[model samples]
Target chain A: MSDNLPASLPGQSDRVVQVDKLSKKYGDNVAVNDISFNLTKGEVFAFLGPNGAGKTTTVEILECLRNPTGGRARVLGYDVSKRSDQAQIRKRIGVLPQDFNAIDRLTVRENINYFGAMFKHQLDADKLIELVDLKDKRDEQFKKLSGGLKQRVGLAVSLVNDPDVVFLDEPTTGLDPRARRDVWGVIERLKSQGKTVFLTTHYMDEAEYLADIVSIIDHGQIIASGTPDQLIDTHGGKKTLIIRDAGEEGLKQLPQGLPKAELRNAGDIAIPLHNGELTNILMSLAQTPLHDKEIEVRRPTLDDVFLNLTGRRVSEEGN
Target chain B: MRSRIYTIISGHFKSWYRSKSSIFWTIAFPLLLIVLFGAIFGSGSTKFDLYLQNQDLSANTPTYFSQGYITVLNNTGAFNLHVVPAEQPDPLTYVKNDAQLHNRGQRLLVIPLGFNATVMSGKNATIQLYMDQSDQASASLAGIVHSVTVSYAAAIAKAPNHLILQQVGIVTKNIRYIDFFIPGVIGMTLLTTGVFGAVNTNGSYRELKIIKKLATTPLSKIEWILGMVGYQMILATISLVVILFFGYAIFGVTATIDIYTVGLVVAASLLFPGIGMVLANFVKEAESADAAANAITFPMMFLGGTFWPRETLPDIMKIIANFMPLTYVNDGLRYALIYAEPAQALTNTLIALGLASFFIVLGSVLMNWKEE
Candidate 1:
C-alpha cells in the first residue's frame, strides 16, 4: 500500500516460486517427501499441513533458507541450490519465518532501516513503518512492544526489499483474534500489490479466506491441493438436511430418492444428500415442510474437508 | 559491499551505545578502576617507621655526625621515626617483636659505638639496619637508611663511601601506583569489551532469531561478522583514547600514545569478536552465553598479567598464563605502553591476528543460516 514498495516491475517473471519433487531428511527421519508446487504472479498460495507434515520444510526450501535433500526448487526463476543464485534469490524474496523477530534493542525505524540496508535496492523505512500502521511507534524500542506490534515490525522487515515473493510461515500462529485480523489485512494488501505470497498456516479458516490456491500436506506429502471451493467440493462430506417439527405425514411426503432419513437427538429428522441429488432433495423438502417447522441445509466447511482428507482436525493433527 | 557492511556496523553501534548497561560495561567500568586506583596511590610519598638506637660509646653528648645523619633521614620524607623512652627494648628486639606479631612497616636503625668519634676522625663507620624480611615492607625503608648513612659519612670524611644494595636509586621521587596500573587497565578494558561484547551479543542474536532473519538477506555470514568486528574496533578505539585521557586528567599518569600502542590495541581488538562468534556456536541461549563467557573470562581476568606480572606467578600458573590469550594481550599492551617497543609486542600481535583469522573462519563454519 506504500509507494515505497515500487510498483511490481512490469517485466517481472510470471512464476515467482516453483518446486518439483523437493525433499528434506534429518538423518533417518524424512522431514519432507517429494512434493511439487508452483506460484504465478500475484497469487496467495496457502500451504497447510499437520505438525511434522513438511509444510515448513517446503517453505524453507523455497525461501532458500534450507537445502533440499532431493529434487529442485527455484525462486524468482533462479535455482535455489546454486550458491551464486541464492544471493540473487534472497535479494528478490522476503521471508517472515515462524517466531520471526526484529532486533529488540533497536527501535522500529532502526530495525527496518538496518534490514533495508542489507539489499541493493530497498523500500523507504519510514514509509514501511507508516504502512505497517506503526507511525507513532517508529522511535520506540522493539523490546517494549506488544507481541502484535513486534510481528508488525517483522512484517515491515520482510517487506524491506520490495520482494517479488514473500514467505510467511505461520504468520499469525499466536496472535489474538484482533491482531490476527490486522495481519490478515496486511496480507490482503500485499496480494493487492501483485506480490506472490507463499503462506503456511494451521488456521483452515484463514486459508479459506485469504488463499487463492490451497495445498494440504500430511506426513511430508501433499494430500490435497486446489482452490478452497474445489478442495471443499472434492474432499468434503455429503451435505446435510435437517427438518424439525415435521409431522409423520410430512416425513411420508418427502422425496424417496433421498438417502435413508434418521431422527437426530435434537428432534430433527436429518437426511443426507446422496451424490447428484442435493438440489432435487432440497426442492422436495421445500415443498413438504410445514409453515411452522424449521428447515436447514448445511454445506460442508473447510474444517470438515480437512477432517475428511486427514481423518483428524487440523489443530489436533498439528499438535 | 560497503553499504551492506556499513548498515550492519551502524546498526550494531546504535544498539550498543543506546543501552546504559553497555556504556557502563564498555567505558565507565574501566575508567572507574583506573581513576580510583590512580587517585589512591599515584600522588604520595611512602611512609615507613624507623627506630634509632644510639651506641656511640666514643661520643659524650649528641655529636654532629650522629645528629646530622638522623636529620638527613628525617628530611628524606621516607621515614617516620618512633620516639622510644630509655626503657624501651633494643632496636633489634623491637623489630623482632613487630615481625612476630605480623605488623607491617616497622624498621630499626642502629648507630654503632664510637659513632661520632669514628665519623669525625675520617674513618669509615658501619651502621646496622634490622627489619622483618618476611613482611616484604622493609626494602624501600632499608634503602633510604643506608643511603642517608653513607652520604652523611662521606660529608664528614670529605670523601665518598662504599655502599652496595640490590636496587640502585637516588630516592628523589617515588613511582605512582597509577603509573604502573594504567596499562593493566587498558588491557582489561579491551579484553572485556572485545570478548564479552562479542560472545553475549552474538549469542543473544542467535537465541532471539535475529541472525536467522538476517540470513534471509543477501549479506553473507562473513560480511555480517566482519561488520561486527569493524564496529567493535571503532568503539574500542574511542574508549582507549577517552580512558587514557581520563587517566591523565584524573591522575598524573602518562602512557605512550604512539601508533604502535594503537596498533597493539587494534590488532588485539580484532581477535575477540571472532572469538565471541566461535563461543556463540557452543552456547545455545543468551543467559547461558553470559555464564559461559564469565566462566572463561573471570579466571583470565585475575590470572592473566593484567593484575600482576606473569613473572610473579608460580611456575605452573606461568605456563597456564602463557596459554591464556589475555596474557598476551596484557603483555603486548604492557610492552607498548611502558617500554614503547612494538617490536617486542610483535609475537603477541601475530598470535592475535592468527586467532582472529582462525575463529572467524571457524565461526563461519559453525554458523549456517539454513540450519534451524
Candidate 2:
C-alpha cells in the first residue's frame, strides 16, 4: 500500500476535497449525516458500505449534482454549494456513477471521441477506443454492445477530460467475474497514470484488493477507516479456524483455554484463537473419536474484521 | 476552459451521432415520409368515398331541392357520391354498419325524412353526418360536404326557379400529409433525440455504474453532458435539414419566413427539449423516461396539428392545442412555409421556449441522483 501511495501527493500542498461537518438530508431522513472526510491527490480511497447507505449521497454532493443540506463540501478548492465554481470543479473531476449508461444507439468510436472532446486536453479518440479494447466494435452502436464493452466505453468517456480525481461509485456491482476483473484492470491502469481514484464498493474483496485506504460507512456515517490489514488488526487478531463434527461429546471434551472462540454453527463451528492452540486442538481432536473430520484454518480476512467490528458481514450492508 | 467546453460539447455530439437511431427517424424516415405521403396524398387526387342515403320519396319532393344537393356534390370533385335510396331492400341499418366498418375516415351523409320538403318549405333541416374521425384523411371531404350542402340551400335562396353553382374554397390543394406533418415530426424527432436519446443514456450510465469508471477521470458531469448534447444536436440538426429539404421538395412546401426567423425558431426549439435533459436528472430509469415522453408525445402529435389543421378542430380542442409547443411550432412553421410570411414574430416563441428550457434545467438541478 505504501508502494502505491505517491511520495508527494498532487494536492498534498492543499486538500483537494474538504467536507467540513458535511450533512445531507432528504426530507426527514439523514442520508449523509454530519460526515467529514478529505481527499488528497494520487490517493486510492474506497468508501465501503451496504446498499442504501449514504455513500451515493455523499459522492453526489461532491459531484455538485446535489447540495449538502447541513454543511458545505469543497472540491478542488471550489465550494460545491456555490454554483459559480461547479463548472470548474466538474471540469477537473471525473465521476463514474454507480450505474453504467452511455448513448445506446451511438457507436463505440463515436461515444469515445465525443467524450474525449469534453476534456481540457483531448485524448486521441482512436487511441482511447483502442485502449478500452473496443476498436473492433467501433462502428457498432451502444445498444449492440455487451455489458462489459459498455462499461469499458463508459470508462473511456470518463477519461475524456483527463480529470484529476475520479469517483467510481460501486464500479463493479453487476459485472460478472471476468468483466469485473477487466474493470479492475482499467482502475489499475488509471492508478498507474497517477490519477486519484475514489471508489465505493460493497465487495470486501474489492476493498481489500484495490483500495489503499478503506473507509467503512454505515447509516450516513464513517464507522472506521484504515488500510485493510490495519482495519482487520484493529478489529481482532488473525488466525480464524473452522472445525466440523465437534460432536456433543467431543465439544464437551474440547480444550477449555483457547484465547477466542466463536460458535459459527450449532454443530459445525468456527473459532478465532491464538496460533499456539492449533497443535493442541489438533492433538486433542486426534485423541478423541472425531478424526478425519472437516477442519480448516486461515488468516483473518477483511470480511472477518468487518463482521467483528459491525456484527454483520460487509455483503449484508448498504453498498 | 474554452477548449474543455468544446471537447465536452463534441463528446456529446459524437455520442449522440453514434448511439441514437436519430438519423433513421430524423433524416431517412422523415425524408421517406416526404416522398411517400407526399406522392400519395399531395397530388390533390384524394377523393372522398361518400354514401348518400336518400330517405324520402314523395310527389311533393321539390325537384330543385334534390338536384341542387347532387349538383353541389358533383361539381366540388372532392367526393365520389354513391346514392343508396331508401326504397332499396336494406335501409339505414346496413349502410350505417358498412360505413362504420369501412374505415375510420369515411363519411356517411344521411338525408332524413321530409329532407326535400324541409328545404322547399324554407325551414331549417338537420342532416345527420356520421364521420369516421379516427384520422384526418377524410377531413376535407367532410368539410366539402357541409359547404356544398350549405351552398345548395343558399342557391335555392338566390334563384327560386333555377339552381346556381357556388364555388366552395378548400385550399388543401398544395398541402400533403407530409407537408402538414413536417413541423411536428421535425420537432418530435428533435425532442426524442435530446430527451429520450440523450437524457436516458446519461441517466442510465450513472445508474449502470458506468460513470463509476469515469469517477477517476478529470472529466466532469458538465463536460459529459455538454459533449453528449453536442453530439446529439449535430445529429438532430442534420435530421432537421433532411426533413425540411425533403418535405419542401416533395410536397411543394415553400417556407414563408426569412432565414433570421428560421434561425430564431431553431434556436428556440432547443428550449422545450432542454426540459427533457432536465428531466433526465429526476428520472432514474429508462422505462420511466420512455413512458413519460410517450405520454406527452402522443397527445401533442395529434392535437398540435401534426396531421390536421387546428382551425378544423373543435373550439375546445383548438384552445387546448394552443398551449402545446408543437402548436406554436406548427403554426409558426406553416406561416413560414405555407403562407410565405416575410418575417415571423419570434419574441413570444423565444420567450416561451426560454422559460421552458429554464424550468427544465431547474428540474435537472433539483434531481437527486442518489435519492434517499
Candidate 3:
C-alpha cells in the first residue's frame, strides 16, 4: 500500500472495502437490503445484477455519494458515514457513474487533464491515454468522438487520480461488442498492474470474464457470492449436447430408449448430459441418420447459473 | 482546492469559447444589437420632449390665449409635448420622476393662472419653463420657447413684449436612447449568459453525470460553485468591455468603469447564476431547465428596462419590474456606466449585492452535490 493510505485497523490491512449489513431505504422502498461483502486488495470484484438491482445504490454508498439508512461500510479504512472520512474516501477512490460524459467541447487530453486536476496527485494524462489506447484521438473533441472512444475517455478519466480502487458502474452497459472488449482489455491492464477495481454490470459474461470474485444481486439482496467457477459449479445445472439446426424431424428420428431430448429455438435439439454419458450419447447418435449433423457439448455458463438461481433469464437489455 | 477551482473555471471557459453559439450570444449577439439599434435610432435628431401643464384654466378648459399659445407651440414641430394634469400639485417632482423613468429630458412648460386676463389687459404675463441648465438641448430648446412666446404674444395681442419666458433650472442627465440602451444591452447579455450558463452547466452536467463524477473526487460543492461564479465574472467582464467598446466605437457613447460598475458586475455574476441554479434544482431535465430559464429571463429582460425604459410600461408591469432581479442590474449599470450617478449606482449595487447573496446562498443550499 502507498504511504498516503491511513494505517488500517486490525484485521483489515488487506481488505480494501468492508460492508456489514448495509441497507439503504427511500421512504417505504428498500433500495439496498441487508448485505455483507468485502473486497480485498488488488482484486477485481464484479457486482452482478440486472437493471434496478440496487447495484448503483450499494456502490454509491461505498463511494460516499449516498448515505446508508442502516449498517456500516468502510472504504480505504475510512468510514463512509463520517463526514471527515468521506473526504478521505473521495481522495482515494475514482468513480465512473452510469452514463457519464465529459465536457463536449474539450479535447480528450484536455478532458483527462481537466478531471485530473481535481486530485492533488494525478497520474500523467498521456499515460492514461496510452493505457486506454486513445492516443490517436487525444486531440479530438469529446462530442466528435465515437461512443466507444468517448467511453474509453471516461475510463481514462476514472484512472486519472491513480485511485486506490476504481468503481466503474455499468461502464460497458451501452457499448458495442468490440467496444466492450476494448474496455475489458483496459480493465485487464489495470488487473495486470494489481489495481483493485469494483465493477457493476448486468452482463453476466462481462462479470464472469473480468472478475476474480462475482456477487449476484437481485431485488436489493445478494443471492450468491463466489468465484465464477464456484458459482457455476454450485448453481449452474448440467451440461447439454447441442445438435445444431436439427428440427422436430431430427427429434423424431432419435434412437429408442434414449434420454429425453427437447427442441429449442433456431431448430436446435438439446439433450442433457449426465456424468460419464458422453460416449453413450455419441454411440447412440452414431447409428442415427442425424449423426451427420454438427454436434457439440456445451458447459454451463453464468447465464445458466443465473437462470437456475432466479428461474428467469435476464434479457440482453437487462430487463 | 485552488487548483481544482481553477481547473473547473478553465474547463468551463474553454467550453464557452469553443462553442459557436456561446460566442455568438456572449459577444456577437450583443454587438449586433448595438449596431442594429444604433443604426436605427442613433443618427436621427429626436424632438425635444416637453411636458406641458396649462394651469390657466376656466371650467376645466384652457382659456383662449393659453390654448392658442399651446397650439402655436405644437405647430412649431420641434417638441414632443406631453400634457401634465392641470391639478398636479407638484408637477415638477412628478415630471422629474417620470422623465428619468422614460429617459426623457426634464423640461416642463407651465402656463400660470390669469394668463388670459393678464395678456388681454396688455399686462406682463410670465410662462415658466422648468429645465436643467446643463441639459445639452437646453439652450436650443430655450431659444425655441422664447421665439414661440414672442410670436404668439404678437399674433394674439399685437404686444410682443407682454409675454416673458422664465427659465427655472432643474438637474437632470442629458441621456440619449442609445446611451440608455447600451447599458441595457450589457445587462441583457449578463442576464442571458449568467443564467443560461449556470442552467446548462448544472442541468446538463447533472444529466451527463459530470457532477456525479466530480462528487467522487476531492472537489467539494463550494469549490464547484465558486468556480462557476468565477467563470461568470470573467464572462461578465468580457461582455462589459466588448459592449462598452462597441458602443464607443460606433455611436460615440462613453462610459465610466467605476467601483460600482465592478460591484454590479460581480453582483450580476452571482445573481443570475444563482437564479439558474435554483431553477435547475426545481427542473431536473436540461431542456426543461432551459425553458424555465427562458421563461424567467425573457420577462425580466423586457420588463427590466433592456429594450425600453420601464417607466413607459404599464403600472402593473412597472410593479412587476421592481420585483425582477434584472431591474436593479440594468438600473445599476445605467447609473454607473452611462449616467455617472454614483449615489444611485451605489444604491442599486448594494441592492443587487444583497440579492446576489440571498440567491447564491439559497442555490448553494438547494444544490444536490451528492446523491441521496
Candidate 4:
C-alpha cells in the first residue's frame, strides 16, 4: 500500500487529504473497498454516492474515527491509522458527522464555544455565528432553532477550530429545500474564504452546485471522478428537446422526417437532440402543428450522468 | 486537555441547571422525599411505649413482688406500658406483630415465673428486656427499667443488688428514624443523579452524534470521562449539602462531615455513573438504557437500606444488601454522619472506593470512544 503513495507526501504539497487504496471492512462485510482519492487545498471535494455506498465509512476513516482494514488514509499530513498521527490529525481537522446535534440546552453561541474549547486555538464564536447568518438566534437554545438554523449552528461549530480542512458528512441530508439552500450559502462562504472542504452527499445537485471536484462512488467503489461538467459530458447520454404540456397528440403530429419522439410523465413530448442538429430540428418543427406548442432544449445533468453510467437513478431520499 | 475537560464539565453543568426535569430530579425530588419521609416519621408522642409480659404467677394471679414491680414501672410515667398475656408462648413475635400494628416500638419486658419465690427467700431474681439495638428509644427505656428494678428490689427485699435487670440487644445511642433516613436520602440522591445523568448523557449523546463529533476533535476519551466524573462530583456534593441542610432545618438532624463522608461521596460519584456507563454501553439506545438504569437503581434503592435499616429486612434481603454498592455507601454515610463510628465508616469507605475503581475502570474500557 505504501508503494501507492504519491511522490509528494502531504504537507510537502497542497494535498489536504490523501487516500491510497483505502479499504474498510467489518468482519465478513466490506464497507469501503480499495477506493483512492486526493483533496487539495482550498478545493471543495464531494464524495457522491447513494445511502449505503460507503460514504460515511470513508469520511470517518479520514476523520480518524475509524481505522482502515487495508490501505492508508491521511488527513492534514497525519496518518489516520497511527495512534500518534491520529492525535495530530484530530487537532487539525474539523468534522461534522452525519445527523450531528449539539448540546440541546446550550444556546447557539454556547454550543459553538463548547465545541471550540476542544481545540488549543479557536476562531471567535461570534464571528462564526455571523458567518452562518445566525446572529438573531445566537441566544436561542439549540433545540429551539428551526432545522435550517440548527444546521447553521452545526456549520458554525464545525468551523470553530479554524481547521486546516473540514469534513462534512451529509450536512443537509434531511433538510427542506430552503434549508438546503441556506446551508449551501454557508458552504459558498467557506469556499470564498479559501477553506478546503471535504463534503459527502447523496444529492447530485448539491455536488454539482458546490464541489470543484466530484467523485461518484457506488457499491463500495468509485465509478467516476472529475469535475461535475466533465463527468456529465463524458457519461451523460444526450440532451433532449421537450414540448411543454404537449400530449401524445404532439408526438403524432410531428413531421414525418423528424426524429422519433416519446411522451413523458407530464404529457410532454421529448425528442433527443444531437450536436449540430438543433437548427435543423427547429426548422422541421416550424412547419408542423406541434410547432405552436411550447418547446425548449434541455441539457443533461449529473443525474443523467449517474443514470447513464449505473443504469439506475438515485431516488430523492438516496435510496 | 485540562481546558477541554473543564469545558465539558461546564457545558454539562449549564445544561443540568437549565432543564427543569434535570433540576427536578437532581434537587427537588430528593428534597421532596426527605420532607415526606421526615414528616411521616420525624414527629410523634414524646412518651416511650414499653410492653410488659409478667409471667410470674401464683395460681394464675400476679405474684406480690411482680405486681409491685409493675406498679413501680407505671409510677415512673416514662412508658405507656401495654400488657402481653402471661400465657403467650413467644412474646417477642407477639410484640413484633402488635407493635407494628399500633405503630409502637417493638420492645418487650419479661418477668420470670419464680420472681416472687426468689425475692421472698432473699435470692437473686432476673427481669429480661428485649429491644432492637438500633432503636432510638432503647437507651432511655432501658435506663428507666434499670432504675425501677433497683428501687423496687430495695423496697421489697431491702437489697438493691438482689434483683437483676438483663438488657438484651442494647446499643446506647439516641438516634431517630429521621437521622438514619437522612443519610440514606443523601445516598439515594447521589445514586439516582449519577446513574441517570451518565446514562442520559452517554446514550443520548451517542444517538445525537455528539460523541462522534467530539471524537474528531483534540479531546481524548479520558478527558471526556474525567469531565463527566468531575461533573458528577460537583452534583454529589450539592446533593449532600442541600439534603443535610434541609434535614437539619426541618427535623433538627445534625451530621458531621468527616473525611469518610467525603470519601464516600467521591466513591459514589464514580460508582453509580460507572454502573450507568456500563449500562449505556450494553443497552445502546437512550430510552432502553433509561429503563435499564431504572431496573438497576430502583432495586438498589429499596434493598440498599435507603428507607430502613438492613437489620429490619428479611434475612435474605439483608444478605442481598451486603452485595450492593449503595449499601456500603449508605452504611458509611450513616457511620460518619450520624453514628460517628470511624472504624466502620472507614471499612465501608474503602470497600466503596474499591468498587468504584473496578466499575469505573470497567466502564471506561467498555465505552466506545471511536466508531468501530
Candidate 5:
C-alpha cells in the first residue's frame, strides 16, 4: 500500500501527520489502541466513530493535550510526545475543542482579536469574521448571540492563526440544520485554501460530503479506512430497495417467496437488492399494498458502508 | 508573549467593566459597608459619662470608698464625671434627663449613707446604678463601673504595701471607630476582588474550555497567571480608593491615604490571587470553585477584623486570625493608618509577602489543565 501510494501520486507527496503504533491508557483502561495512520499534506481526513471510540483521545494526543502510553505521534514534523516541541507545534496548528466558548462579555470581534494576539502570525480579525459570515454581529457581545452564532465565532477563533492544520472535534454536534450547513461551508473553504484539516464527527453525511479520506473507528480500533466511494463499493452491496410510508398490514400483503428486504422504521424497508431479481420482485408486488406507497432503488451510501463495517445501526434519525 | 499578556489583561478589564452590575458589586458594595459601619461606630470617643451622688459624704470614714472609686475612674480618662447636685436630689432623674438631652452612655452612681463605713470595717457595701438598657452604649457602661469599683475595693482591702494595679492610657490617640475601621474595610474589599474574582475567573475559563483554547495556543501557564493577577491588582486598587474616600468624607476617618497604604493594597493584589488559584486547583467546576472561595473567605471576613475588630474575637479565633493573609493586610493597613507605626507595618508586609509567594508557587505547580 505504501509503495502504490508513493508512485500513484504525481509530484507532491508529504505526510503532515504520522502516528505509529500509538496507544493511550488510563491505568488499566485503554482508551486508544496501538492504532497507526498517516495524513498527507492538504487533505481533509475524517475520523468517524461512536461516543467512546477513541476519536477524541487520538486527536488530543496529536494536539499535545494528552500523553501517549506507547509508540510515537508527530505533527508537522515535530514529535507530539516531547514537551520541548509543544511551543513550536502550537504555533503551527489550531484546535477547536468540544466544549469551547469565549468570554461572554466581550464583543465577537474582541474575542477573535484576543485569540489572534496569542500567535506570532495572525489573520485580520474583521476579515476572518466576515469569512464566517459574522460581520454584522461583530459588535454584539458573545453572550447575546444564539447558539449557532456562537459556534460560528468558535470556528473563527480556531482559524485566527491561519494555521497550517486545524483540528475540529465534533464541530457541528448539537447544531440545527441551517447552522450545520454554515459550518460545513466554512470547512470547505478551509480545505480549498490548501489547509490540512483533521476532523471527527458522528454525522456520517458530514464526513461523506467533506472528507477526502474516512476511517471508521470502533472500540479503540480502526476497522476500515478509504475514500467514501471506495469503502461503499467494497463493503456495501450495489443497490438498495427503499420503501416508505407503507403500513405493517400493507407490507404483509406481499407474495411469499419474493425477494425480501430489511425492515426500517415507520413502515419503511431498505435492503440490498438481490441480483437479477428486481423485475420478478416488482411483478410479484404489483398487486400488493406497498406498490401504492413511495419506493426507490438507489446505490449504497457511506452510511451503509459505516453500518456494515462497525455494526453500529442507522436509526430513523438518519445519522 | 507580552502582547498576549496585555491582550488578556485588557480583555479581562473590559469584560468586568462593561457590565453595570459588576461595577456596583466590586466598587459600590464595599463603599456601602464602610459608610454604614464607620458612621455607626466611628464618630464617638470611648468615654462613659457618670453622675456620682455621694450620700455617704456627710457620714464619711477615714478611708472614703467613693473618693477612691472616683479617683480611679477619672485618672484613666475613661469616665466623664458630673457631680449630682444636692438641690437636684435623685441621681436617676439626673441620668434620665442627661440621656434625653444626649444619646450617650450616661449612668448614675449613688453612694449609700453607710457605704464608706461598711467598706472601712471590711463589710460588704452596695452601690446603686441607673442605666438605659435599650441603648447599646449603656450596655458597656455598667461593666466599666463594676470593673473600676472592684479595683478600688481591692486597693482598700489590701494594706498600703499590697498590689496596687494602675490603669495607664498609653494609646494616646483619641482614634474614633471610623479611623480604625477604614483600613479594615479597604482590606476586606481587596480580599473580595483578589480571591473571589480571580478564582472564579480561573475556574470558569477552565470549565468553559476557554483555558483549553488558550492552552492550545502559544500562551504559557505563567503568562496566564500573571495576566490574571495583574488585573486583580488593578481592581483591588480601585476598590481601596472607593472605600477610603467614603470613609474619609462621610465617617471622618483620619488615615492619610499615603504610599504605604497603596503598597499594602498592591501587595494584597499580588498575593490573594495565588491563594485563589490554590483553592481553584482542588475543584473541577466553576460552582465548586465559588463554594470553595466562600469557604475560605467567609470565615476570614469575620476573623480578619473586616467588620469586627480582632481584639473582640475569642482566644481560639484570635489565634486562627493570626494565620490568615487578610489578617496581616488588616494589621499592616491599620498600623499604617491608625497607629502610624511604620515598624509594625513593615513586619506585617514581610509576612504577607512571604505567604503570598508560597501560595503562588504551590498554585502554579498544581495548575494542571489536563483531565484524566
Candidate 6:
C-alpha cells in the first residue's frame, strides 16, 4: 500500500535460498552451467539476462521443479536434493512459470483454490482474488481471461500459500505497456508485504523500478551482481545530456565551457558526464548553441550499466 | 506433498467436470451410441418379406393332398406372408408378379398346379422357392425354410394314410439378444473409455503446456499418474452404472450376479483405461493420439466380435482378433454374464490386466515431465 518500505528488521536471516554450483545439461546443450547465487529474505532480487541465458533454469531449480545434474540447492534451510526435504521446501516457495498457464476449463476461483489447497498456510480464497484484482472475474473460465488478467491470476496463484519466496520467470513478457505496469503494481505490493520476490526480466526499466538487487546472468553465469544504484555507480556508464539545436553549425560552435559530447544527429549532441553537473550544462547551453532548443539531462540506468559492463547495449546484446 | 498430490488431482477432476462440452463428448456420446445400437438391433427382428402363390388351394383339385400338407405350407411364422389365390388362371402371369416381389427381396413360394397330386401320389413334389439373393440373411433363411418344406413333403409321402406324422426332433438354444449384445457393449464402452478419454486429454494438456507447470510443482510422476488413474476410475465407475442399467432396461441384459458382475466390469473398466494412458503417453500430441487410438479401436470394435461373431469374419481376421485385447474383454464379459463365472473369465482378464499394466508403465516411461 505504501511506496516507501520500512527499515530492515533486526534478527533477520541473511539468506532464504542458496544454490551452489548448479548445472543442468540436456544431452548436448547446457541449461544451467555451474552457477550459484543466494537470495536474502525480504529482498526483491532481479535475475537480469538475455533469452536462453539460464535465468529460467536457475529459477526452476530453486523452485524444485528441476533436479540439478551437478549441484545443490536449499530453500528455507531444507535440502532440495533430499526427497523428504523437497516437500518442506516446496511448501514454502511458489513458482510462476514463463507461460503462466492454468487449467483452461476450470473457473478462476477454482484454479486459485486448487493451488491454495497445496500448501498448509494458504490465503483465503476471497483475499487472494482481491490481491490479484480478479475478484470480478472469479467465476469465469480460466481460458476466457485476457493475457494481463491471466498474469495477475498467476501472481495470485503464487501467493496462494503466503510463501516465503515467490519465483516469477519473465512475469511481464508478452504484455502491453499498461498490463506491464499493472503487474509492476502487484510485485511492488509483494515486496511491501516482505515476501522475497525472485524474478527474471529483459526489461531494464522493470528491473530498475522493482529490484533491490540485480544480478545480470550470461551463459549460465552471473556477470554482474549488486544493488541497482551500486552497479550503475560502479560498472555503469556516465549520465548523458541530450541537446537538439537549430543546426549543426550551432552545435559544432559550442562554447569552451561545455563538456565533450557525441554527435547523435546533425542538430543534436549528447554530452556524457560522470558528475551531476546537468544544471551547469543547461545554463551553458542557454547562452550558446543549444539556446532556444530542446535539452534533456538523465541519470545512468540499468541499460547504461549493462552497456558499460558488456560493451553493447542491452537490446543489441539480447540478439 | 501428499496434500499437493491430492490438490492437483482434485483440481484436474474439477476442471474437467466444469467443461460441459468435454463431458458430453467423452461420456454422453458413448451412451448415445449404446442406445442407438441397442434399439436398432435388440428386438426379435425379422429380416425378410415373403409372398405365396397357391394355384391349387381348393381340396377338390386332383393335385390336392391331405389337409395337413396345406396346413403346414400356409403357416407363416417369422415372415411377412402375402397369399394370392390362383383363380386368375395364368399361373405364368402369377410367377411374373411373384418374381417382381422376389426381386424386391420378398421370399416367394410358388405352388404350381398338380403340386397336391404329386404329393398325394407319393412322388417328390417341388414347391419352387424364389427370393432375392441381394439380402444375404434372407437368402440363407430361404434355403433353410425350403429344406424344412421338402422334409415335410418326404414325411407326408412316407405316411400318406397316417397323415399325422410323429417322431419329430426340435432343438432350440435359449440365448437372447441381450446375451449377445451386453458383452459387445461392454467391450465398446471400455475401448472408448480407454482410447479417447486418456489419449485426447494427455495430448491437449501437453500442447497447452499444462504438464510443464505441474512438473514444476512438488508432484512426483507416480503421483500424477495415480491422480489421472483415479480420475478415470471415477468416470469409468459412473459410466458402468449408467450403461449396465441401460443394458437391463432396454435389452433385458440383467447383471444377474449384480454384485460380482459389477465387480468384474469395474475391474475390467479400470484395467482398460490403463491402455489409454499408454496411448496418451506414447502418442505425445492430440492429433496423433486421436489417430493412434482410432487406428487401434475402430478395427477392434469391428473385428474383435464386439458387434458380430468373430467366426463370421475370415479366418485371417479371426486370427487378427486373437492379438486384440478387446476380444478378450468382450468374450469374458459374455462368459461372466451367462454363467457368473468370474474364474472362467479370469485367465483372459489377467492377460488384459498384464497388458494394461505394461501400458501404464510404458506410459509413465514415455511421459517426460521436463520436455523441450
Which candidate number would show the highest lDDT if scored against the true structure? 3
Worst 10 residues of 6 chain A by lDDT: A1-10
Candidate 1 local Cα displacement, residue B66, angstroms: 24
TM-score (chain A only) for the predictions, listed in order: 0.81, 0.85, 0.95, 0.95, 0.91, 0.86
DockQ of each: 0.54, 0.30, 0.86, 0.82, 0.71, 0.35
Top candidate on DockQ is: 3
Candidate 5 lDDT over A200-238, as tens digits, reads 987888989999998878778877888888888898766
Comparing 1 with 6 on DockQ, the higher-scoring candidate is 1
Flag the better candidate by DockQ, 2 or 6. Answer: 6
Selected candidate, larger TM-score, 3 vs 5: 3
Best by TM-score: 3
**Per-prediction TM-score, please?**
0.76, 0.70, 0.94, 0.88, 0.83, 0.75
Q: Rate the local accuracy (lDDT) of all candidates.
A: 0.74, 0.64, 0.91, 0.89, 0.77, 0.70
Per-residue alpha-carbon lDDT of model 5 for B126-208, expressed as tens digits?
77776556545555776677676766766788643222222211222434456666777778878877888778888988877
| True C-alpha contacts between chains kept, each model in order | 0.77, 0.51, 0.93, 0.93, 0.79, 0.48
lDDT per residue (tens digit) for residues A1-319 in model 3: 1112343673357888888888999999999999888888999999998898999999999999999999888888889999999988888898889899999999999999999999999899999999999989999999999888899899999999898899999999888999999999999999999999999999999999999999999999999999999999999988999999989999998888777999987999989889999899899999999899999998888999989989988888887
Candidate 5 contains a number of clashing pairs equal to: 1
Better structure of 3 and 4 per DockQ: 3
Tens-place lDDT per residue, model 6, A38-104, is 7788999999988888888888777766778887777777767777877777667888888767778
Collision pairs in model 4: none
When summed lDDT is taken over every stretch of 10 residues in candidate 1 chain B, the lowest stretch is: B164-173
Number of colliding residue pairs in model 4: 0
Candidate 5 residue pairs that clash: B42-B178
lDDT of 2 by residue, A76-167 (tens): 77778776777677778877777666765567776666555545566777776776777788888887877787788777776767777888
- Provide interface RMSD per model, one decimal: 1.4, 5.3, 0.6, 0.5, 1.2, 2.8
